[model samples]
Target: MPRRNEDALNFLLERRSVSHKTLTAPVPSRAEIEVILTAGARVPDHKMLEPFRFLVLEDAALNRLGDAVADRARALGLDEDKVAKARFSFDNAPLSIAVVASLKQTDMIPEVEQTLAVGACCTSVLNAALASGWGANWITGWAAFDEPFLQDHLGLAAGEYVAGFMHIGTVRSEPSERKRPDLNAITTWVSS
Candidate 1:
């Protein structure tokens, strides 16, 4: 019989991302952040491509990124409010770990699979932070999608993309429970 880890299952079922804006000071130390990164790197990698990397943004870096986003928005002639909102995640969060998807030129593993691996890495980082008693949220806003902003601020390569910006810090308030999708409606059993 397989051993049942009810506690781990419950944690997974109950885990919900905290808002970046609601996160405050007391960011994780270098060692603690390393732990989170290690956990994140544990994600499954088909063909062992490991086509992803992380950029740890703290203190002045966040503000610099915010400025870069705003500048990109202005250069693109986007609405000021939208531009401000695009940078809201960086402006409010004490620390953010940017999950960068570095697409590898591998015939064995498709580019789509590599992209999915990066997304999994981002989720792993979020879960690691939450399990370690910190407030964490995975975000990807307009700034993340803006190629010019990413190239100017993050120095992303042509084949790379931002999978997520995981904000981590102390929780300011208890987040209210949000509605979840009905599993019955989404699940399908295939017996062939």
Candidate 2:
């Protein structure tokens, strides 16, 4: 018989994301961060493509990225408030892992499946951080979809794009449980 991990299941059921603004420094050390990434990289991959990679943003990198965001904001004619808001995301997080999806053209697996694998990597990173006793949240804003921002700031290559940013840090406070999807309503059973 397969043994069940009740605690792991419980943690998933009760998981809550710590807000980006609430996360503080003294984030996961390099050693621990490596472990988190290791866990995250173990997600499913069709044809074992490994079509994803990570870019860690911390300290000076955060400042650089924030400046880039501010520049993009100004170029886009966004008001000061909007620019600040955009920069805040990068400046505030103690550390963030950029899960980048780089899809490859292949006959074996569909490009969409490769992209979905990248999405799974993002979730995997989020879960890994949470499981390792760190506050974590997966986020992506206008900056994520902006090509110039990604290329110039994050140094993403031609096919590379941000799947999600997994913010990791010390948990400031516990968050109240929000509503969950009605599984029964969403789930449909079909039998032949």
> What's model 1's lDDT at 111?
84
TM-scores for all candidates: the values are 0.96, 0.95
Tens digits of per-residue lDDT, candidate 2, 68-157, equal 899999999999998998899999989999999888888999998998889888888998899899999988988887888899888888
User: What is the clash count for each candidate, in the order shown?
Assistant: 0, 0
In candidate 2, which residue pairs get closer than 3 Å at backbone N, Cα or C atoms, i.e. clash?
none
lDDT per residue (tens digit) for residues 74-130 in model 1:
888989888888778788989999999887897898888888888889999999999
Clashes of 1: 0
Task: Write down the lDDT that model 2 would get.
Answer: 0.89
Q: Which residue pairs show backbone clashes in model 1?
A: none
Which candidate should be chosen as best, given TM-score against the real structure? 1
Q: What is the lDDT of residue 190 in candidate 1?
A: 100
Q: Name model 1 segments beyond 4 Å from true.
A: none
lDDT of 1 at 68: 77
